[model samples]
Target: MKHPVTPDGRYFVVRGRLWRMSNPKLDETQRSKLTNRLMSARRAVRAAKTANDQSAEAAAHRAVDDAKRVLGERGPVWWNDGSPDLNRHLAKNTPYAEWYGQIGRSRPGGT
Candidate 1:
């Protein structure tokens, strides 16, 4: 399912938490390549877990980390606005609280 992105495009909200978005400045081709690599690494992690191979899992995890870092998802904040990175922070506790609250209120049966 698609998640809601913040107005500044710096993050997307999932389960009421903010997750940093990738660098929007990245060219489409480069983004696609990095995304593909990230997916492959994720699959490798699952395969290693299913095979009960701890070493392989560790290596796969590293690969995943590397892919994410390069994609600007897990390392430094991609925005250059000097804003503090709020990745993984609960939306209700962050600057997005008011906006997130409006989202819930706009949805049917939302409280």
Candidate 2:
């Protein structure tokens, strides 16, 4: 949960991993509007309780998804680099496997 944004604020580091994040395609006004809406949706999701709130939460989640897409954090990537998206995999299992293992002892139970 420690997501520290990089100096340029274009990426955030979590658990020793840097995740690409940027939304240059969105103007300040538009981005702020979407961001506010997304925050409201997230709050709604957290406060959900009644049966109707389930559907409300789902709608809120959709709003968040849309906002993220517009912000270039979801859908297609913001960068033009040809490298494959490795965000979904752990460094220990991806191309960085060897490097990660070299810095630490093996995990318990062979994981």
Candidate 3:
């Protein structure tokens, strides 16, 4: 049977919708480190807002973005395949639209 997720576990398919999941290969230590960085950036965003630090806010945003990119939530896809990213796309609106409705019958959420 065909698998919904990619071989790397970085993306999953649901009713033809591609959802980006964190890279499963990430080690515990690395995951923890990145999580900490993300949290710190989040805090910095709040602090910068209160302190009116525009530069600090921009830097924190970049840090958060970098952490997310590393975590496989945003930025370039983890997959090296040339297939286009379907993130945030609806099955009915994408190339898979033809079969997405049929697959919906077995879709977990059935939406």
Candidate achieving the largest lDDT? 1
lDDT of 2 by residue, 1-111 (tens): 244444444455445464657577778898888888778877777776444678887887887788777777777777666655555455555555565455334433232
Query: Model 2: how far is 46 from its true place, Å?
Result: 1.2
lDDT of candidate 3 over 1-111, digit per residue (tens): 253654445555664576776666789899889989989999999999999999999998999989989987788776677867777786577666555566566656654
Predicted model with the maximum TM-score: 1
Candidate 3 deviant stretches above 4 angstroms: 1-19, 90-92, 95-111
lDDT of 2 at 79: 64
Superposed by TM-score, candidate 2 places the C-alpha of residue 75 at a distance from the truth, in angstroms, of: 1.1
Error of 2 at 107 (Å): 24
TM-scores for the candidates = 0.93, 0.62, 0.62
**Native-vs-model 1 lDDT?**
0.88
Where is model 2 more than 4 Å wrong at Cα? 1-10, 49-52, 88-111
**Prediction-by-prediction clash tally:** 0, 0, 0
Model 1: how far residue 20 lies from native, Å:
0.9
Against the reference, the lDDT scores of all candidates come to 0.88, 0.63, 0.74
After superposing candidate 1 on the true structure, give the runs of residues whose Cα lies further than 4 Å from its correct spot. 108-111
